[model samples]
Target: MAARSALAILAALSLAIGGCASQEQPATQPSPGGSATSGTTIKEGLKIAFLPKQVNNPYFDTSDNKGGKPAVEEFKGAYSQTGPSEASPSAQVSYINTLSQQGTDVIVVSANDKDAICGALTEARQAGAKVVTYDSDTNPTCRDLFINQASAEGIAASQIKLISDAVGPDGGEIAILSATANATNQNAWIEMMKTELGKPEYAKLKLVTTVYGDDDDQKSFQEAQGLLASYPNLKGIISPTTVGVAAAARYLSGSEYKGKVQLTGLGTPNQMRAYVKDDTVKSFALWNPADLGYLAAYAGAALASGLITGKEGETFTAGKLGEYTVGKDGTVLLGDPFVFDKGNIDTFDF
Candidate 1:
């Protein structure tokens, strides 16, 4: 059944991206009260802010359309999408200040720097705007709720497994290619991967090195080349950052190591499609970013409308999406990370 699902995904991708056909959105019912929960209503024209790590990245762009825009439209609330051209905390801070001045009822953000944005987020909260972090998170104390894509353990373990499978049972040297050194999510996942790699079950896998790319495509490409030169026996490269994975794949595809080395990590299907189709990368993983955006939008709106308060251990329904129990730390896990390979990579559009 899984294999069949994967084949269907690939077929859909072929049709969508290969220009074989146009894509369509799935029809979904509107949530009760025209929102996720009952008794929550925005002032006919309330405004909410949807900010991401950067603009123009397919990942965040899809989030805007599938996540924030739809929620605002459904509630008849005004929605604005803004962020830095680059994924920088200073840029995000600027936007947050602007949004606060604009009197946004809620601010939903995918933070660029974990701790640096806390001050700004606190200010926004103080100004009566409910704050929620998604895609990435800020300090739990500073934000009302964090909508996590998956648990740190799940993300780390999956990457380790992908590397182990690529290297086979012989247990060869493996290295990591990551984004900026300060990226909170990437650092947490790397730590988790290290822990998983040391377990007895993964005795055959040896992690040799880790390199940072600062999420720059050119820099990531150069880093990939450097890793190949530095680790002559490196069997696989696990890149947890989308930029790193795509850069590594692009580098390997044109180099002698194309099939000699294995590549796997968090990458968008569109960006990594060529590498996957050419067999340069075996597989990668990501959740539906659109769904992530959608959930974040709902959470932001719910918090603002008083339909649901951002209390730890609180349970509430997110309109038509169903019920969600807030964890002890005010964090909400959307679910596990979805693995994508040749089998199912084609089915998803974003």
Candidate 2:
């Protein structure tokens, strides 16, 4: 029953976003004194900069407009989202430097390369800008907060479960289609999935191969095709990246193995809907990105307003968002992974 529902949702998402897969970047300006109206008495006109891994991906674009910008406006601060045209850590470092030099009060970022961007984040902190990581995280010591959408273990385990289920109780050959070889989150999740696959319950599941898509739609699509050609008995594909998932689904949907091979991974509802409808993918998981952005803003505002410092084990209330506790490592898990399927996919527009 669960598998059937997930298949339906994936189809819906593919139909919704596949035709308009071209990335769009939207700019958000401060609402007219909406920040002041929130009535949090703090120094007025604070400036916060949000740096995503890339500027054009719909995932981060939604975060900027729906999550970060409104939170800034509610706090009577200025917010801007900027990053490179592509996911380049070096470019992100340059933007961090520029924001720091401009005397920004806070800077939140989704890192492109985890270690490569640490120095820049540390430098921003030294320049009196509170550094926070959202989406993809940096080194814990380098940033004050990490706004986690979900725990690393939880996300990876869920993907493994989805694939294990799709391949049946008696698992067979499977492969992973991942984004960039060096992606921190992807690597972490892949590792966890590997561990999960080793469990006795999944003894028959064999992760035979791994491929990189570099988060490029074309590259991912080609990689999926190559995997299919290389492994005739490939039972499932766990694409941990959003781009990889969509690309794999599209490839499978058009192939003779449409329902024979299962594709499961993290993807936006709008991007994987069609594949689900065609029964190319069984299930996938992701947190609400907009809520992630919203929570990130809430955390940033709480810190800026002196409501809560970025200390481990600290707790604070985000207006209308309820309470959150800072974990021992300065990371905050927003919530559980949202598993989307037919039953509830239509209920969520984003």
Candidate 3:
């Protein structure tokens, strides 16, 4: 993992060096929302701000500080992070307005609501800031690019598979404890999870219900408790949010359901390691959040640099993560989710 981080930093630095010497050329692809510049060199001192769903959240801290901060440093850009402490539909609107007013060149965000922040984001773009949404996204028209951790189908399938494996041949009731109801990414994944459950292979598994945790630890803990109490026959749980998963693990670890009930979802290794070791969780999945933010920073820089416009087939390099293409809907996929269990959970720190 340390080597991976070192390589990522080195790659960003290499991009910076290459940008300085690259010759200018006309953009081959046309942009939808704006025109692409011929400049190949990434501009230094560009003010890049990360507006996550919440401030001081552990997941965002790792993504913004460890991932985004280093990428900005590599590109010689000023970096900052600001947002609400709680994840809510309109919590990020004020921060977006502030960043726009402050003349930020790039605004990387994980939106809480798809449309709630679109107006503020559009205003920022009109003010000349490049909007790049990651982790979660806003309506496509608002952002220049979206850095998706993985495909919604892939993430949903992985979680369903994990829970199915844990529940065994005679699958019973299962429930999802997700983030806020309005979270775009979470809602997308949940819908796909429902689709996956419809398949014949998973016919034995029945989805009991889903509850919202709002990405709050205490609320998620209580929600997990509620789910168990309300559905005493529940056999498994899937929490696709880091906060919800960790909180659910904590609740299950101290209760009678520790080994009897299966738990799996998107979680950082640091938060799920104990649960895995204690037999409270079988396995969970997530892409490296740090890499997700690193890629977002690079994508934002690319937009700001005019290296590539946010158009289908547009390509740009993302440090150690290598080259990426802008797929449909102005989105770049980071990769697939990785499952962590007791066997290899110890190898990761974040």
Best by TM-score: 3
**Candidate 2 lowest-lDDT run of ten:** 25-34
The better candidate by TM-score, 1 or 3, is 3
lDDT of 2 by residue, 1-350 (tens): 01124454344334323322122212122223122232334445878889988887878876777667765666567989988977766778889999999998888898877899899889888888888789888878888888987888989889989998888987899999998887778888889999998899999999999999988889999999999899999999999888889999999998998889988999877787777766787778887676677678767766665555676666655433445777768887776676766555555555
How much is 294 displaced in model 1, in angstroms? 0.2
Write down the TM-score of every candidate.
Answer: 0.87, 0.86, 0.90
Per-candidate clashes come to: 8, 14, 0
Candidate 2 wrong stretches, greater than 4 Å? 1-43
**Global lDDT of each candidate:** 0.77, 0.76, 0.86
lDDT by residue (69-107, candidate 1, tens digit) is 765666667888988878777778989999999999989
Give model 1's TM-score versus the native structure.
0.87
Error of 1 at 246 (Å): 0.9
What's the true lDDT of residue 153 in model 1?
95
Point out where model 3 deviates above 4 Å.
Answer: 1-37
Q: Write the per-residue lDDT of candidate 3 for residues 189-286, one digit (tens) a residue.
A: 99999999999999999998999999999999999999999999999999999999999999999999989999999998888899999899989998
**Residue pairs in steric clash, candidate 3?**
none
